[model samples]
Every structure is written in C-alpha cells, then in structure tokens.
Target: MDTTIRQQAELATAEIAEVAAIPLREPGTELVALEAAPAPVAEAIRKRMDELDMTNTQSIISFGSAAQAELQQISQAMLADVKNKDVGPAGDSLRGIVSTIRGFSVSELDVRRKRSWWEKLTGKAAPFSNFLAKFENVQSQIDKVTDDLLKHEHVLLKDIKSLDMLYEKTLDFYEELGLYISAGEAKLAELDATTIPAKEAAVAALPEDDKMIGSQELRDMRAARDDLERRVHDLKLTRQVTMQSLPSIRLVQENDKSLVTKINSTLVNTVPLWETQLAQAVTIQRSREAAEAVRDANDLTNELLTANAKNLREANAVVRTEMERGVFDIEAVRQANEDLVATINESLQIADEGKARRAEAEKELEHMEKELRETLASAKARDASSDAGASVPTA
Candidate 1:
C-alpha cells in the first residue's frame, strides 16, 4: 500500500489490536454477568424445560413408573421359570418377559439419567422413560429460556441499529439544511455578478419623468423595493457555505466507540485478576425443565428477564450440584478456553510471524464461510500503481 492507504490500514490494525488488548473487566454489567454465568448454556436449556412444565409434563411420564416395576417383576418371573425348567407356552411366556425386561432396562436408566430428554421422546422407546421422567420438563424449559434470551438480545440489537440508522438519517437531514444556506448565498452572489446598469435598464424602460411633477414618491418606492431585493441578494451571495461534508466512514462503523474501548480494556486485560472472583459469584449446572421454570419465575417488569434471572439461578445451582457430584471442574475448563483464545489474539502484536499466521487464519475463516467467493473479483483488474496515482480519493 502507498503512504495514505498504509496509514488507513495502520489505523484499522491499531483499532483491532486495541480491541484484542482489552481487558475482560470492562464488559457491560449485563455481559459481564452473563460471562460469569454459572452455566450460560444452561439458560437456553432451562427455557425448553419451562415449556415442558406448562403442558402438565408430569402426567406424560406415568409410564416410567410402570415400566420400572414391570422390569423387576419380569426378572423375578424369568428366574422362577429357569429354576423350574418350565417349557411350552409358560416357558414362551417367560421368554417374552425376558424380551420386555431388556426393553425396560434402558427406559429405567434413561429416567434416572435425564427425565426431560427421555420424556420428550416418550412412548417412542420403552427405555429412557426414567430419564425422561427425571426432567419432567427439560426441553420445554430450555426452549423458553433460549427463546427469551435470544429475543431480548435481538431487541437490544435492533434498538441500537435503529439509533444508528437515525444517526445517518440525521446526517442527511443536516445536509439538506446546509443547501438552504447555499440557496441564500447564491441569491447574494447574483448581486455581485450583475452591475448597477442592469438595474438602470428597468428604470430606463419606464416613461421619461424629468418634466413630470411629484414623481419622487414613485421613484422612492421603486428604489426602496430595489434596495431591499439587492440587500437580500447580497446576504445570500456572501453565504458561501457548501453542503455539509460527510463524516469519516469509520464513525459509521462504531457503536459507542468510547464504551467499546473502556469495556475491552477492563474485560480482556484484567481477566486473570477477576476471573476467579467471578467464578466464585456464579454457579453452573444443567437441570430439569420444571425445576428451571420454578426457579426462573419472577415478578419483575420484564417477565422475560425475571424468568431468565430465575432460570439463571437454578441453572447455576444445578450445574454447581452436578460439578460437585461428578467432580467435573467447569470453571477450569471455561477459563482455559477463554484464556487460550485471548492469548492467541494478543500474540499477533508480538511478532511479524504472528501477523502472517493470523492472516492465514483470516483467509481460512473466509474460505470456511464461503464455498464460492468470486462476486467482487469479476471487476476488471488494473495496474496497481497507476490506479493508486489516479485521483479517486483514498478510501
């Protein structure tokens, strides 16, 4: 790139780099809380579970209890048949019981594991009934929460975009306002363009009045009108202001750039210091749908947020419970993922090699995103230096 283009590129790079350097502590309170969520994904899962509860999900899993009892009975019958060496129809009956026993085993285990999943797929399989029984409402609750969260986020994004669009529209409006000033200026400029002889022409067009008496009143009125028009014209002519120039395009891309900078600085840079503390404040778990809805139910103005908050708390509790029960370290894993991504990005500023590596990654991302990327390439190619020299104004 030539000097000006290079400067633009450098500016872009510095902005991105600054973003990369941003500390995690600077995120908005909402995003920070979400990042620190005990089980963030659990929020989505909880919504689905809630919907399950609304349908009287408990009634749908009645087969789970019966299935378990039947399995135990079948096992008892099979044992008796085997001991007595029973044969014929009675033996056949026991064999059938064995088959049913096998079916019920999975059902029993599923209910014990995750009732929501099992019940949602209820009746499709004899097994997993128990797992389905466990959640009683997992999918429904998860769906509800997921929908609500996505909806809330979408609305916020739309609001920001609407404001952004209005900002652009306002620029356009101001542009038109500027032209009014220009129109006035043009009228004034006309006075400079024309000579006083042009005014005398109109006066000459009138009948000779030298011999007439009391013609001064008519002359005075004519002069007064001419003077008023001339002065107004002069004022407009001096108003040489042009249309308002468009702002730099970079300003268009930003949504509260200052806020972005501040948040990035706090969130990314100070992550190590605050991550542990954040982890302590939150919990994480996957729980049943019914349980989540109950936990999420809130009396707040936004039923959605209130519900989400409740779901968040329940999800945190469940995830925490699961973490303890299964001895799984959720925080450690989350931290590792977050830290690794951050480190890779920060390394770009350290070395030229890193920049090239990141460039390769960027290309890779582009390729992955597009199976066919030839749309813009159809434009005719030109000599790079010649084009750069051309006065198209630097982008």
Candidate 2:
C-alpha cells in the first residue's frame, strides 16, 4: 500500500507539474490578444499552440483531476493500512499527515466538482462571451457580402438579358438591310435584262438621218430614248446610295456582334464563376466562425477547470498548515462547502440563459442557410433556362 501510494503521488505530482508548465492565459485573454495584436504576432501564437499539441484545454484539466483523485485514494488507503499494522511514532506521524492531506484533497475535490458542474451548466457564454459576439459579427458581415454580390449579379444578369434581346433585333435589322440592298441590285439587273436592250434596238432601227424630220415617228422614238436614259441614270444613282450605306450598316452589325459575344461570355462564364466563388467564400467564413467558437469554448472550460484545481491546491495547503499548528476548523469547512454549492446553483440559472441564447442563434443560422440555398437554386435555374433558350433554333 505504501509503495502504491508513493507511486500514485509521484504520478499526480508529475501531472500537476506538467499542467502548471503550460502557459494558459485567462479565458478570453487569448482572444483579446489575437484581436489586438498584429497579424504576424497572432500567427505566431497560433503556431506555438499547435506546436504544444494542445488542441483542447479542457482535456488537460480532466487529466489533472483524474490523476489527483487516484493519488488521494491511494494515500488514504496507505494511511489506513499503516494504522492497522501498529506502526511506531515515525509511522504514526506519517499516517497523521496523510490523513490530513486526504481530508483536504476530498474537500477540494468536492469543491472542484461543484465548480465544474456550474461551468457546464453555464456553457460557453460565461467565459467566452466575446467569442460568441465575434462569431455573430462575422456571420453578419458574411451575410452582407453575400447580399451585395447577389444584388450586383442580378443587375448584371438583367443588363446581359437586355443586351441579348438587342443583339437579336440587330441581327434581324441586318437581314432586312441585306434584302433592301439586294432589291436595288435586282432593279438594276431588270433594266439591263429588258428595258436597256429593247431601247438600244429601237435606236439602232432608226434611220441615220442628219436632217430633223417633222415625222411623229422620229420625234416619238427620240423622246422614248431620252426617257429611258433618264430612268437608267436615276436607277444608277439610287443603287450607288444604297451600296454606300451597306458598309455603314455592316459596321453597325459587326459592333453588335462583338457586344453580344462579350455579354454572352460574361453571363455564361464570368458571372457564374464569380457567384460560385462568392458562395465558397461564405462557406469558408462560416466554417471558420464555427471552429473559432469551438476553440473558444474549450479554452473557457479549461480556464474554469484550472481555477478549480488552484482552489483545491490552496485548500490542501491551508489544511496542512493548520495541522502543524494543532488546529482544525470543521465549521469553517462546512460553511465554505455550502457557499460553493450555492454558487454552483446560481451558475446553473445563468446556464439556462445561455441555452436560450444559443437556441435563438441556431434558429437564425438555419434561416440564413435556407435563404442561401434558395438563392443558389434560383441562380442555377436561371442559368439552365438561359442555356436552353440559347440552344433553340431562331426563326
């Protein structure tokens, strides 16, 4: 039993020493430091925490408590066994010391347990309230960013849609312009095909007389030739104007085509890609917020546990000092224990408030998530409809 007690004490002492060596700041202090410090300093702190292999501070406290309890139990049993063996003065003195220490350890353990229960009841809000606030703030900022991006996307889509309609109208106009130009060419061809040839034949059939004959046939023939020449000259001038206008129309059509291509590219590729990336950014930010919340909660839990351990150690020291002075204070111990229980109960009430707050936060998050999902679905449907419309054969 003595050997077992010695081993257990040694193990407990080592555990305690290990925990003490870790430079754990008070709850929320690290978060504050992180917020206030420069980027490089914050990053360095993060790196240091990672190197220590201390992902969860609560685990350290739990291990320390378990080791301490094991040590206390072994020591108690050793003291009892020594009393039964009829040990001498030296052994009696050792047993007395062990009994006092065991008593103090038991009281300390009870207080620690009460404190732990209180902390658990309060949840993360007690020690890490600022972290919760920060999480909410980040979420709000992300929501704003998403809203702004969606608004811009909506405007872009609307403009692109309008551009697409204009492109189709421009194409139809180009076709109509081509038909108008073609009609002018056809009119010119008709003159060459029938009227010009017939007129030339008539002029050739006329007698090559130098004298102005008073015959009606000569006058009618000359007049008809003159009328045909005027018609041909007017047709050529009209065709020249129409032909000149073609290049300007074609230039406009080329510009329309380029504009259409650009709008289509933005709609099909750039806008969608941007929306996707924005969604991913929101997701990443939410994930980061969640992770920070968890880490902060763990830090708070560890802080509470450490405080409990310190109190326990102090209680043990007081008991040991009183024993050396040949004094005991049973009433004071009882009062302290009662006060601790009352404090724990009050903390439990606070915990209820925290739970309520947490529930409200969860509901808000759910609503936001639903909104985001619907928005994404709407965007996808719009994209799909646009694609289907684009693939259809135009009349």
Q: Tens digit of lDDT per residue, candidate 2, span 224-323?
A: 4444344435434443554454454344434433433433333344434544554464466557668878989999999999999999999999998877
List model 1 lDDT by residue over 179-231, tens digit each: 33233233234434553345455555667774233245445434544544443
Q: If scored against the real structure, what TM-score would every candidate get?
A: 0.21, 0.23
Residue 300, model 1: Cα distance from true site in angstroms: 49
TM-score of structure candidate 2: 0.23
Highest lDDT among the candidates is held by which one?
2
Off by over 4 Å in 1: 1-150, 195-197, 208-395
In angstroms, how far off is 147's CA in candidate 1? 6.9
lDDT of 2: 0.45
Cα shift from native, residue 297, model 1 (Å): 41
In model 1, how large is the Cα lDDT of residue 110?
27
